[model samples]
Structure formats: C-alpha cells, structure tokens
Target: DEPGLRVKLAEGPQKFYIGVDPTGPSLHIGHLVPIYASAHLQKAGHQPIILMGGGTARIGDPSGKTELRQMISYAQIDKNIASQKPQISKLIDFDNTNALLANNADWLAPLNYIDFLRDIGRHFSVNRMLTFEAYKQRLEKGLSFIEFNYQLLQSYDFLELYRREGCILQIGGDDQWGNIVAGMELIRRVESAETYGLTFPLVTRSDGKKMGKTEKGALFLDSSLTSVYDFYQYWRNVPDADVERFFLTFTFLSVEECRALGAAEGSDINKSKERLAYEVTALLHGEKEAVKAREGAKAAFSGGGDKSGIPSEKIGKAELEAGINILDLFSRTSLCSSKSEARRLVLQGGARVNDVKIEDAEALIGMADAVDGELMLKAGKKRFFRIELTD
Candidate 1:
C-alpha cells in the first residue's frame, strides 16, 4: 500500500546496489531502514554493493528536502564517508566476497562534464525527468541545475556498477523512487540490460513526524555523537500506537512473533517495548552496551539499582569547589535546552537533585550537595542525569 513501486523484478539471486548520500557528518537512525533492507538482501544470499555517494554528496540530493543543502568541501565529504563506513559495516557483512564497499567518486569524480551531458544526458528526457516527484517538488521553489543533474549521476552509478560488477538492483528510501527508477531505465537504455529499483517505505510515526528525532537532536549510530543509553531510550519510549508497526520495520523478529508481541494489550505492551528497545539497541551498540543501557533504564524508571549506566556528566575540581548554578549546569550539560527552560522546570518542581525537588530557580549546588561524589539529576519523570565530581 506504500507509494513508489514502478516494476517489481522477479525474485531469486540478484546483485543489489544501494547508495547513501552522506549529506551530514554522521547518519541518523532513519538511515538504518535502508541499511537493514540491504542486510536482509545479504542474508537472503544476494550480493550487496554498498556505494557511498562521495561524488553526489558534493552536489547533494534534492529529494525530500524543502530547502537547498549547503555544499560541503571534498575534505569534509571524505571525512563523513570515513566515519560512516564502520557504522554501516556493523550492520552489513562487508568482508564477504558477496559484498563490496565502493565510493561513487571513483567513477563520478573524473567524469568530463561535456562528455557526461553528451552521452548520459542525451539519453535522459528533460520533459519526462521533470515529471518525477523529486524534480516536481523542487521545481516550484526553483531547483538548481546542479541538483537537477543529481539523478543523472545517481543513475550513472547504477550503470557504472552494472558494467563493473553486473549489479542490477538499486534500493533506498521511497523518497528516492524517482532517482532509482531513472537508474533502472538508464541501465536498460544504455547497456541493453534489465535492472530493478526497490524502495522501502519512509519511517514516520503515527504522530505525523519523522522518527529518530528528540529534544536532544537526531539519534546517531556513533556512540560518541548519540550515547548508547539515549539511543536505547529513544526506542524504549515509542508511543503505544506505533509499537506494532515499528516491530516489523526495525527488528529482525519473525512475522508471527512480532504479531503476537505487538497484539498484546494494555500493560503488557511495556514488555513489548522493552524487547523492541533491547533488540534495536543490541543491533546498533552491541549486546553488552545494550544490557548496561537496559539496566540503567530500569534504574532510572524504577528508582532503584546502579545508576552508573544512566547518562553522567563529570565536573572539574574547580567546578565542584566553587559550586555551579543549577540552571547553568543543566543548560551547559545539555540536560535542558536553555537556562530559561531550566528555570521553568525548577520553578515547576520538575527539576530535582538526588531525589529532592529544587526549591528555587536560582539554587546553586556546593560541595556539600555531592553525595558520595555523585549527584543524580532528574528532569521531569523519565530523564535522569548523574553529575559526578572529580575530586
């Protein structure tokens, strides 16, 4: 029922090529959907060609964006690609002979503009290309010529890979349906070969917002960017209405098992959530980190157990000695968005230190407040941060 299915290629053994445009320094949780889909292909004995859009990233893919993306230098693009390689390898088996890791820059960088426009460009019809949703959405807002060429380059990636490795299938999020089909058509026209484009549904919550976003920002795969605890908790806190669908989309659980768990009613849904949280966290951050995060989550919500697993902030010797203002502390440590927000929470009794409600917005904590060299900070019901002082 999801949109964007042009031609369903017959299933069996096939070479699949999936590309990720590294628009940012790190990938968010949304990128996982396609990566998981690629993993599913790898598991089914199909070959996976993981293409990093190093070349296309320079111009940017205009699909599913309201505003134009700022162009990044080649240096930055390489850096982002280097960082993402490991995060992706964690999900897909890159070491196998059936898999390949490629960057489009290898073929796309040295491409002569005029020759490209003459050959590949000649095959594409501008009139028909504009009809695709990707170009249509940006046309009203005035799409750039460079962005307009993005589909051509992406399509060329498929054609190039098809020649080099005989890769015929391309997969990505449904928003990329237009570019994908363009690639398929390119292969058929130029190489006289049949190719396929499969797009998975875009991830969106029942609330009508994209998933993997929070007050903190995007849920990143890298633990340094988004901690394991925060990542685990994001999945743990999914709405009751969405739990059933997410189980199928994110987890590798069998259909019948997911159906049975998702169908559970009322309080029993919490158990389903815990499983979802644990399973997703394990996949992203290994089972050991997931176990620790689970324990920390249990302690945060249940009011007992070791709180070391909870997100902790370390204060300097001078900081602990001088005693920091609670508002400033929360704001600086990213517990609260701003000092004013921290003030509001404190005044409303939503801010607490070591299980004690903060009485004043201007309250400051001195050394005496450091219980056993660590202080537990609670922002409202579910958020917990442990402030530890280095003596």
Candidate 2:
C-alpha cells in the first residue's frame, strides 16, 4: 500500500529501471525502501536495470535537498560508488540474466553539449519546468543553472536507457515523482515510447521523521560506518508505533502477521521488534551477521555483550599514557561528535566505561582499563563500543 504507484502497469510483466547517486560513501537505511521495491519488481519476472548516477552526482539533484550540495571530487565519487556496489548487490542480483548495472556517466559524460541540447533540450519547456516542485522550491533562493540542468540530464538518462535496454519504466522515492514524470515525457515526445513512472512513498516514522536516522546520523549499511550491533539496535528499539509500519515496509512478514505482532501489549511488543531487527539486518548484512548481532544485543542488555563484537577504536599508547579525557575519547570513537556532547552525555549519566556509568566528564582512560585489549564503552543503554589501547 505504501508504494503509491503514479501510473498503471501493463497487463503483463515489463522491463524497468531504478537508480541512486552515490552521494555518500555508503547507502543508508533511508535507501532501502526503493531498493526493496526494485527487488519486488525483479521477483515479478521483469528486467531490473540498476542505474548508478555517476553523471548526476556531479550536479546534485535538489528534489529533497534545501540548499546547494557541496561539490564532491571525482575521486570521492568513485570511492563512494565502489563502497555502494556490495550493498546494492545484496538486494538486486546482478548475476540474474535480466539484471544489469548501468552507469549514467557512461552516456552523459561524453555528450556533445550542442548536439544534446539540439536533440533533447528542445523537447523540454522552460515554462513547464518552472512549475515542478523540485525547481519551484529552490527558486526563491536563486537556483543555479548547473543544478537546474539536472532534471534535463536525468530525463536524458531514461531516454538513453529506453533505447539501449528497452527499459520502459522508471521508479524511485516519492521525492523523485517530478523527475520521473519528466523522464516519461521525454521518452514519449522523443521516441513516442510508452514509458511509465512509479514512485514509492519515502519511508517515514509515525512521528513523521524519515525512517533510518539516529541522533548521530543516517543509519549506514556499511559496518565500518555503522556497526552491525548498532544497526541491529536501531531497529530493535524503534518506537512502538513504528514497529508495525517498519515490519510492513522492510520485512516479508504478511500483513496479518504484522498486524498480530503490532497489536501485542506491553513488553510483548519487544519481541516483534526483535524479529524486525533480525529480518532487516539479515536482508542487509546476511543471516550470520544478524544472528551475531542479536546475540550481541542480548549480552549487552543482560549485563554486557561480547566485547569483541562491539564497535571499537584504537587509542594511541602515548595518548592513553598521558591520560586522554573521556570526552575526547568518545569524540574520537564515532560514539559522539564533540567533546561538549561527550561531556554532556557523561555528566547526564549516559556514558559508560566497562559497564560502569561515568559520574564525571573528566574520567581518563589508561592501560589498566584494557582487559585483553578491549574495554566496553556504553553510550546510554542501547549503544556499546570498545576502546583498545595501542602502540
């Protein structure tokens, strides 16, 4: 019900495409909804072309963003795409005969500007473009020409793919409805192609904030960026109101089963959450990692989890010897963003070292804290980390 399709699908199966720019080092939880939608499409016996927006990343899409995005170097974009490959593979099987990963940079980067403008830009109406939500939102702030051209380039991608792969449909998050409709119009006007555009609702919590974010940041799929334990816990502790909606969106649980689980009273609802955590974690990281993460959660809350699996950072031996403050240590560990935040967490009784809550912000770490090269640093009740002293 959440996938709010904009156009009707044909009576039979068809080929389609879905894409995302590698704007960051890894895809976050926010990205899973569309990717999962692609998976459902793949299972329905249709060709799924996974588009990598290398060309578009150079010019940020302003659909959901409020301001100009900081320009990123090509080197960083390549690294970001490389980091995203594994995550995408886990969801959309590239080995399938119908599945192909295409990069828009291949076609867009080499375009002769004048030729493209003459052939493609002529089809677009600047007057009609101004009416799109993506551009209208930024008009008061003075949208840049480079950013304004993004929709045209993206429209060109759909046209190019339609020719090359027979990809007749495009899908994305609801924020992309304007862009997708633009692409559909481009294909129809240029090739008289019967193309389609569909968009899924942006996954949102009952409270209205977009799902897949924590106080620290977006929940990234990469373990190095967001630990497996933390990833599992993010789902494990979602708001009771969010549990069923997340189950309906993220997992394969049937509607009746989701209803049954969501309707549980009191502490029983936690079981449904645990199931939700395991199912989503398994979808992203595999069942083995999900099992380990679940056990980690149990150990952590039931006194202490496996210290080795907790997210950890190595402190320089000299820094430990000289007595590094607890505040700075948290800042360095990705557990907290700054010393001030760490101090507040410590003073408020949310910071812990070796299972004991910190009573002061000035607490210091040294060699003695390390037991077999690890010490657990618990942030409040749900997050855990390890501090390793090293030379």
Clashes per candidate, residues 3 or more apart or on different chains:
0, 3
Q: List the residue pairs that clash in candidate 2.
A: 299-304, 299-305, 300-305
For residues 160-227, what per-residue lDDT tens digits would candidate 1 score against the true structure?
99999988778899999999888888888988877777788878898876799977788898877787
Q: List model 2 lDDT by residue over 217-282, tens digit each.
A: 889999988889889989988889988888888887789998888888798999989999999999
Candidate 1, residue 324: Cα displacement in angstroms equals 1.1
TM-score leader = 1
Candidate 2 wrong stretches, greater than 4 Å: 1-10, 314-322, 365-374, 388-391
Where's the lowest-lDDT run of ten residues in candidate 2?
1-10
Model 1: clashing residue pairs? Answer: none
CA lDDT of 21 in candidate 2?
84
